[model samples]
Target: MPPGSPSHPALTPRRSPLLTLVAALVIVEALILVGAAVYLLHGLLVEDAAAPIAAIAMVVMALIFAVGVGFCGWGLLHRATWARSPVVVWQLLELAAGIPAFSGGSPWVGVVLVVPAVVVLVGLFVPSVSAQVSR
Candidate 1:
């Protein structure tokens, strides 16, 4: 197949492996956030009236983040250039959060948080992924 031809992998604007990985990570993160939001909302409804405002606030934050991340992931899968910046910002935030979590009592939580952020950041910055997104 010729370059830029429909069947030519190099010319096709397809999701590079790295981009796919980043998108998958973002989607997974969104799902987790959504799950947390659901759990928080459920607790708010089922539990006593203590700290209802805090629980409501957390639920709202989680839902908002879940939607944002989910939208970014969808854009990434579609190769939308605008998606890159937000994802990068999110990864940086995640890294910062992970660093603190790492020092806390739960090392496993830190590892879980840090590893995916690092992977997604590296993947997003890779030459192939960048080029694909730039197209």
Candidate 2:
């Protein structure tokens, strides 16, 4: 703890199961992004493979999801108290998206994602986890 070295208090790390749950969710989101990227890349390169506009849209969506996961991951890692609410919102959106994705032989994808979503939602509601995140 050398104060003259200019350590940042804002960079302090907090450990919590909730953060782990959030990290899991981020990982699941990255998997989904990879899946979409693979499909989109194939579509773009193949001759008359599929609807070009639709393929492009999927790639864009994947990029957006990746960016979002990064933002949420940062907040969770930093243990920002206010980040919980937005993260919860992201989980709900993921839940909605998982419905269709899981139905088409994507069960594992949904399972990986939904587990963390549940954890995050529960943590946000419970007093103990909330207090830890607040710290």
Candidate 3:
């Protein structure tokens, strides 16, 4: 088909595999945050938690962050260009948090946190993934 024709591949952008992977990773991260928020809420409501107010605040913040990340992942799935930077920023922040977990005597926690961050970070930059989102 002609380059600018309706039948042209470029005219109908397909989601690349790497982009799908990135979106899935981001969504999973958001879900994990939501789970953490639920845990905080449970502790605040059902357990003798320290500083209940702080725990409530933490739960609120976690839920907000989870919603934001979930939206970003949805945007990425739809190939929205604006979603890319926020997702990248999130992965950077995740890496920052994950690295500290290692020295905090939680190597497994560090690995769980770091692996997806690294995967999404690399996937976002992959040529196919980058091009897909840019469209």
Candidate 4:
């Protein structure tokens, strides 16, 4: 088939394994955020949150970030170069949040939050992944 043909494998650049890993991690993070948003919404609707307004605000924020991060993951799958920066920013924020979890006596929570952020950050910077996204 010609290079431009729909069936041609070369029509889309191949995603490197590291790139795929980063994308998958980002998607997982987005899904988790969505879950968090739902939990916050539940609190606002059913439970007696001390600060209902604050809970509502948090739910909105989580939903927005979840959508943004989800799109970033989709962009990565499609090789959109613009997706990389937001993912990097998200990982940084995750690290910041994760580090505090350790000090709060929830070391397991810290590990859960920190590990994937670190992995995605490292994967994004790998030579192969860098090259892949640049195209």
Candidate 5:
């Protein structure tokens, strides 16, 4: 088929409001991860007591999540069906981490993580959003 054939899906899918919100949330999460990575890297450079290995590990962790989740969000924005599973898995992991943080005396951090996870979870599962992405 030709690149612009009528039967072919457009490179950018029509986005529902919920899907837009989901994409925004995912992007925000990616930005947060990047910010953390930068902070860790800065600490690694400046803080003498900070173990270099631990700092590097933290930066790597942040980069992994930023790239992985960010790619999933980008794919979701393009309406790729494959994006949904990884997103759901990421949200589940976020929820799992949030729950422990919530009970571990850092209620604020838990709320910050959990609220978006819950919102994304609900938004993704909405019938209209799901249908649009699946198509």
Candidate 6:
């Protein structure tokens, strides 16, 4: 709203929900990594290939999450509008993945994963945040 500052012509978009979603997902994944490490210890071990594969997967996932969160947050804060869907899909997929495991495992897993998952999904659907994505 500054005078003579060359307005964007379009209204500034808001994507904080998406950015927040990414942060929550990152936290959930950190917990997952800890849980997996616990399982890998104390004779709850998986097979040979499984250990290496899990390690690689964790490393890659951490990198992916870092980049995705950075990009989504930057886009959201700057009103870039185009960063919404990828973040949405990413979080949804992680949520979906936690479901079956939750049913088979302890209750806390689902509780941890679902809360933020729902928040992020629902938050993105709201009028203000939804408007950013629609663009």
Report, for every candidate in turn, its global Cα lDDT versus the true structure: 0.87, 0.70, 0.93, 0.91, 0.87, 0.60
Residues 1-135 of candidate 5 have per-residue lDDT tens digits of 676876565754567989989988988888888998998898888877457887898899999989999998898787789989899998999899898997799999899889999999999999978987785
lDDT for position 47 in model 3: 94
Candidate 5 residue-wise lDDT at 119? 95
TM per prediction: 0.84, 0.68, 0.90, 0.90, 0.85, 0.61
Clashes per candidate, residues 3 or more apart or on different chains: 0, 0, 0, 0, 0, 0
Model 1, which residues run further than 4 Å from truth?
Answer: 1-11
Better of 2 and 3 by lDDT: 3
Every model's Cα RMSD, please?
A: 3.3, 4.0, 3.0, 2.2, 2.7, 5.4
lDDT for model 3: 0.93
Rank by lDDT, highest first: 3, 4, 5, 1, 2, 6
TM-score of 4: 0.90
Between candidates 1 and 2, name the one with more favorable lDDT.
Answer: 1
**Comparing candidate 3 with candidate 6, which one achieves the higher TM-score?**
3
Error of 3 at 54 (Å): 0.7
Q: In model 1, what is the error at residue 126, expressed in angstroms?
A: 0.2
**Clash count, predicted structure 4:** 0
Taking the tens digit of each residue's C-alpha lDDT, what string does model 2 give over 1-135?
664453556554456676566656665666767777777777798857558888788888887877776667666666667667677788898788666768879998787667667766776667655765675
The number of clashing residue pairs in model 6 is 0
- Higher TM-score: candidate 2 or 3? 3
